[model samples]
Target chain A: MCTVCGCGEGDTKLEGQSIHQLPPHAFIRGAGGHHHHAHTHSHAPGMTQARMVQIEQDILGKNNQYAARNRQWFADRAILALNLVSSPGSGKTTLLTETLTRLQGNVPMAVVEGDQQTSNDADRIRATGVPALQINTGKGCHLDAHMVGHALESLPIDNGGILFIENVGNLVCPAAFDLGEAHKVVILSVTEGEDKPIKYPDMFHAANLMILNKIDLLPYLRFDVAKCEEYARRVNPNIQILHVSATSGEGMEGWLNWLQQQRP
Target chain B: MHEMSLCEGVLQVLEDEAKRQNFTKVKSVWLEIGTMSGVEIEAMRFCFDAVVGNSLADGAKLEIIEIPAEAWCLNCAQSVAVKQRFDACPVCGSYQLQVIRGDEMRIKELEVE
Candidate 1:
């Protein structure tokens, strides 16, 4: 069972259900009286013409609208919202917990966690005494702007503070979504392939910064740090790369410094 | 699937336009999807069929116009056609290609009544 949205397993219903009724249609008998043809027309006179409507609009326009609203909301409150995205098992939760633990009392921070199921990540965040809200996407692969806006209602964020939105453990779908974040920080573990940036070029191109985690395991694995940076730069010329190990606390200071610099 | 939510977004636009333009039903929808948009055409069609059910656009035909991805080769200093995001320049065989076009996902027009 999902905790945040109260959605249970095996449930496939869509949210915000709306009742719709079919428009009036008249079935007219044919001249031979052997067939019936359905005719649908407008009730108002002279308004039944089928015409082409010029609607040149983006398919993600609605989500962008919600994202813009969230952006304005953050701007008004002086909140620096960072969206942390990475593949599953890249150690995002670990990094977040460590960051929160290190910056405790020095910064007023709140976390919004996203996952396909389970609130274990949020629970982990709360264990560090930081406020966290979990958004179980259920069958959703990523969180949209509308969902994040709703989550913000229950999450009490501090002014002039940071709001870390840990996105679902997916690379493709999340790249196309904008949850009103100031910057997208993509994490790449040293345990994974160095060519991940090129493999998932869309995610790498969309992200402003790429955090290479699990540097402590570099000696144990054949993950090429330089190759990874080169691939990321090829995808995005201006992407900032950081090497960090949440487990060993290596490069945490630089990560923390980057976060502090983003604040207003 | 993200395609499901994208179909839902299209429905929202149709419904909003119905109120603003005084149209009760939609007959067809034309979408301009770029090759580099990362949206699978078959997946989008399936999601559209499922999402438009019981709505004003129920049974509405979806017509997709695929926009080919375009990029500028820094080595050749000319615009070139490419398939994927990481595609090297076709002219100079350089990986320094900067994407200039494509990645559009838009509803260009609609047939409604």
Candidate 2:
């Protein structure tokens, strides 16, 4: 039997049950379909009486382990790490560029940009005179803790500084992997459907805050600001929200002030 | 969409167990997937089968036990069944809730030889 959880029926129990389910930093997606069953088929011929090896392990255990180590590294340096996530065309890069430009000399900052291809986003961040590391995931859709840990070497962030990790332009896959950030800020543009929170509940619930971007266009668009906030709150009650437009610089003060307060 | 990566994670765990527990081949794998975990069973199985080809877990049966999410309603101070992350409290219809269970993907048990 396994010593920790007493899980196996075999004489030799595999040790280490690193299975843990945290409240959510938003990661790896595997949802839908209500099929639930205990499946057991016939074993391979001549190999009878399969021993039930009790090995209770979390699927995300390895990623979480790497995340924990990265978290410790950040903690030791007193760095405020933030993960920014959103769907494609959410103006995340624009907002990031505008924010970095405004807070350039006020705070020491660095960025790690994640994408499936190209170093375009990192190059955009570099335009603002900030150190940016581009992690081209190639075939991968999400940036896990292990990749972020390796990216740390490339992006030399100073102590007491802030590091923003811009995840791939995906709302689903990125929600399941923790990148060892102090907070996960999800940016949702007003142009998107108000029911986005309901459609992507896991991401909304995992995020510490939701940035309602492109508010300047709200006047031209029919987006209901109240309804959008209401929908977000329905999914995650404790999530803090802010409205801003990187283009027009509307509500940029609140965004900047929020970052300052989080500085270690 | 990330079901492939999640499936790969499962494979890694299986390979580790094979090395540590002296199992040469795996016959079956049991996974406990939470409803609120956002993992689709069909996609997970597809990815599992595709990746297991030529590996130690080739032809292994994938068993999934769907776990229902549970949360504590702050308004009514009751534990309610949550099928999804956005599910409101069944009692008071309040959104304020503290999730107590689910949001997990654990390898519960395995059949090996």
Candidate 3:
């Protein structure tokens, strides 16, 4: 998708009309690769009293529009969409794989995996026998709403199904981009610093829940669970914390129950 | 890298406004970026030129108005300046600080022809 404008990446069409038409800047880079400063062609000498347009617009206005549409789509289907975010190697895929394996017969699920370059994660997900689509962002840092909306059209998720949009494993960039998910689940492994929530306040603040994963390894790690939760609460008081070990299947039932509670 | 996308957003806004105001060219843009918005000014500026290169805002001067981070200390009952998100309240040294402002990224105005 056009990550910058939050527009569909390819020539996405519904029936006969293009959906989320390309933004104007796409045409900018489309025409040339250079900045033209030679406004001297029409200079009226001095400042020329250039008109000031009071455009108090947010930079992410377009992205928010895309997100709103995506949100509505999910709502219409009663689909439980979750944007899974965290730093690289924080057990997002592991947790997801395990969740899918356990809940396979209980609930319908699909996944849209975001990676810089690779179908590896999607392949792993598909191995669990559920539909999974891979989104190679190339140089893109995060998965924006536009890309997820496009993925939704291809995934076979139906009403009352769960859609997991596993965002690129970056705590920083993904914090700002909303994928129209019902909630953002951030996973932090025991190996990571306990103060991560404070360090990356934006991501934690944006997240609705924090999954402290790899608790099975906590016996060998020095990660302070209480302090971590404290820091998380310091930034986001209402962020629910889940201690789970995808490896050991600990706390899986609670996770599943939480998912069930969110279903419409 | 994310800054590149942000610059693209700036260009997109300028392009939209151009149509609304009937300006054929853009001369300058003033943007307000808060310190707590998690955006880097250096990186944003570096990517701005390239992102706006062929767009309507091409060669347009980017004037950034940096807004300082502000937080309301729950314990102190007053808003205080914060250098970062996790800063302790300057008055009470408490972590019960709520962000009040300085988290917005908005285009304040545009100079166009």
Candidate 4:
């Protein structure tokens, strides 16, 4: 299911791949090039000179530009975009469903679901009576800003609304791609290892907040809440941690309050 | 792997540079990959070959310059070398390390004709 390179996940039918590939016509390309110093040497007669061109550029430079545009779009519309990242089965969709159900009539909300192959998550969000769009990464591992920029075209959103971008379930790749969200919220379930923050430090480091989901099962499991929080803080000193069970709605008020506070 | 997408990004830069800098062929590429950049060097190398095939950098040599991860330890008030994201400050054993450098993946230079 690795859409980043399309290897190893095995289920690569890519049903939504072709649909998402439509050119983002509204995207404006900025003039791009760095101040490069090219050193040339003509070694032989009638031979092409071998030159070293100094092209100092970030590899994710293009993606960053798109993310910047997306950021601008969100800012202009006063949209509270939250990029939710986590490993598979971390109950991200469950949390979103619960959050949407609670805030249905109060606030305007939209969702962008990222998965490798299916529109199932988007279906769940739409079932909640919220506008939802699905972005299947195909063999891709993460959702880049370009895909999101395109998704924004079809999504019906109101000003100052919450747009939750549920990133493809991966701790490794999604951390690297920015989708123009205000904050990255990494979800870690108690069913998973408590040391996941350390094991996947890149993700924990990138996230501004960490939601320790499925906390209602704490009574049945040996998961240590304090230890997990400590480990998360080790990688990300300023990361705010929240404990919640999307299924049982435990500690959801704090989660909702936090969401409300993030709104512009 | 994301390394594959990273390789695609490298190829894209090369293509863009080719059009701007008036280079039809790329001979070699020098990449600066930081240790804390979360990129596997071997994976990058493996994907690079597959990505640049039949492109402007079809036969280009790939050279990666590994950058060591360094962070500013607030506890010790000095820069410290770090190997991982969870590494504590060597002197004070504190986790309050603000990364100052070494989380980059950049195209540093290119040998073109």
Candidate 5:
């Protein structure tokens, strides 16, 4: 039987046999199925141009519900949660490592590191003496709200502290689903082209803050720092841009100051 | 990669709807993908084939309808098609705009037998 539409076994006729015997939509049907009508439409045995549309079920509805619950939970506890998104090798882990190291013992912090198949980022954060949870997504490209809920339950976070969720390294898929964080921080490396914000504007536009990482390497590469900032601002004028070099600690103090201000 | 998870969600909803309506088999599935949702339609079709195996939606034809991006212009007080969220109003150069459509990913309808 035909699969595209479910109209194969009707009383319609084609060349010799019933319309079902012919391929789908072989004959042209007019407005009334005869000749001389206001509209000349094509119709086969089991195919009609009439679009069937009525049912409405939001695909992301379930995920959004869970995210709302997670957001409520975070708000109730007065926890400052941030979801970190960036491309691969954008220094997300390195920057996070520096942030945790500098804020260690000063503020109670927890980390949820998401990766395709490794605990290396979690291990790096654990070395800083803060609670860390490693979520191996297997083949999944992004972390959803349900995964964050589970990771939050496993990690030991004190009241009124920072919760950093390092999402899987993808600028596209991660922007679609919210992980119930207070802010979405997009990290960009100087090595990546300035057109990144324009090509992947959804991530840049969705982010509340944009961090330009690897500034110390600016002297070696031909990356235009001003153009990068301009493109990001063009996409999202309200996005706060910060430049930092995770290796040399050149811009770490400003980032630390922002972190301190988020504390409740 | 995340497409498989999305397909799984679709199958779950299909099962629930089938049980509620007492349908034996699903003939077709109509899906609406928003431009701003970041879901690749080709990947979704492939994932639908793989994840629907041995399920109620097995052998179901997948039909995808794309939704265009629409934003509400604060200055013009009109809704218009836009490529991105931060796009200025075509009528007036104002950045203050609210996105009203094209951010949804949903299953519109399913033809069942």
Candidate 6:
């Protein structure tokens, strides 16, 4: 049996009771062929359209509930949780390495690295001497709150620590789910086009902070930094943007300072 | 894509409803995906076909409805249509805005027989 919730195959007694229950109006199938309804006008050959009229269902509600519970747990521990989202090769790992190197020993830190297959990022963080947990999503495009909750159980939950969750490298799917983070940071590399923010506005709009990484490669690449910032601001004017080069450590002080201020 | 996981969630809900109401099969599904939800409609549709192949919703048709991003402008004290949450108010051009809606990806209803 799964000890946490007593849910697996070993706990057949608890599993016997089905949690699926229909609403009161789930029936009421129309007798005639023309079951006209205002909300759902379309009709199938055999299926009654009225049955589909009123279904007040919230699909993601269950996930949101778990996320709320996780949020409360983080609050109780005074952990500053951050969820990082970006595309592949966006320098999220490099930025995180630099951040951990700068903030190590100054503040207690932990990491939950999300990837489709490997524990490479987690290994990198472990090399930094801080406690890190790796979650191999295995074809999963995003990390939901439930996964984060499991990662938290194994992590060292010291008081006033910062927990950084590096979401699977994708700009689109990761924004939909909340990982009980205090803030969502989106990373954009200079090698990527300046139109990335405009092309994927949803990711930029959902983020609280945007990090313009790979500034060290600016001279080699044809990326326009001002245009990139402009498009990002157009998508989300409230987003705080910081330029940083993890390789040269250029413009990293401001990013570190911002992170330090977030620690409770 | 993440759609397979979402389809699995839908199947879980459908199976729960089926067991409760003694229903047999699902005919169609109505889903509402917000602009800021970060879900690709095409990918979701593709995954729906693959994930529901052996389940009760085996041949169910998936209908996706897109919801535009919207926010409440504090400066103008009104709700306005927005493409992004942080965009300034269309009328007032103020930076102050609270996102009131358009961050939902949900299964609205299921048509079962």
Best by TM-score: 4
Could you give the interface RMSD of each candidate, to one decimal? 8.9, 8.5, 2.7, 8.9, 12.3, 9.8
lDDT of each: 0.84, 0.81, 0.84, 0.86, 0.77, 0.75
Clashing pairs in 4: A1-A9, A3-A139, A3-A140, A3-A141, A4-A140, A4-A141
Runs in model 3 with CA error above 4 Å? Answer: A1-49
Model 4's TM-score against the true structure? 0.90
At residue B36, what lDDT does model 5 achieve? 66
True contacts kept of each: 0.56, 0.61, 0.64, 0.61, 0.31, 0.30
Candidate 2, DockQ to 2 decimals?
0.37
Tens-place lDDT digits, model 4, residues A84-135: 9999999999999999999999998999999987899999999999999998
**Can you rank all candidates by DockQ, best first?**
3, 1, 4, 2, 6, 5
Off-target runs (Cα >4 Å) in candidate 6 are: A1-55, B16-25, B68-102
Pairs clashing in candidate 1? none
TM-scores of the candidates are 0.87, 0.86, 0.89, 0.90, 0.79, 0.77
Query: Ten consecutive residues with minimal summed lDDT in candidate 6 chain B?
Result: B1-10
Chain A TM-score across all models, in listed order: 0.84, 0.81, 0.86, 0.85, 0.78, 0.81
* Least well predicted 10-residue stretch by lDDT in candidate 2 chain A: A9-18
- Give residue A107's lDDT in candidate 4 (0 to 100): 91
- What DockQ does every candidate get? 0.48, 0.37, 0.61, 0.48, 0.19, 0.25
Model 4 docking grade:
acceptable
- Look at candidate 2 and tell me the lDDT of residue A228: 81
Residue B7 lDDT (model 3): 81
- Write one digit per residue (lDDT tens) for candidate 6, span B1-113: 36666766666677677788767777889988887666778988877776666566666789888888788887899998877654678989875667777777777877776
Q: Per-residue lDDT tens digits of candidate 2, residues A1-264? A: 123222211111011111122221122223433333444676677865578999899998878887998999899999999999999999999999999999889788999888877778888999999998887765678888876776775577889889999998988888889989989999999889878888988888889989999998887888888888888898889999999999999989999999988877
Q: Give the per-residue Cα lDDT of candidate 3 at A83.
A: 95
Q: In model 4, what lDDT does residue A127 have? A: 97
Sort order, TM-score high to low: 4, 3, 1, 2, 5, 6
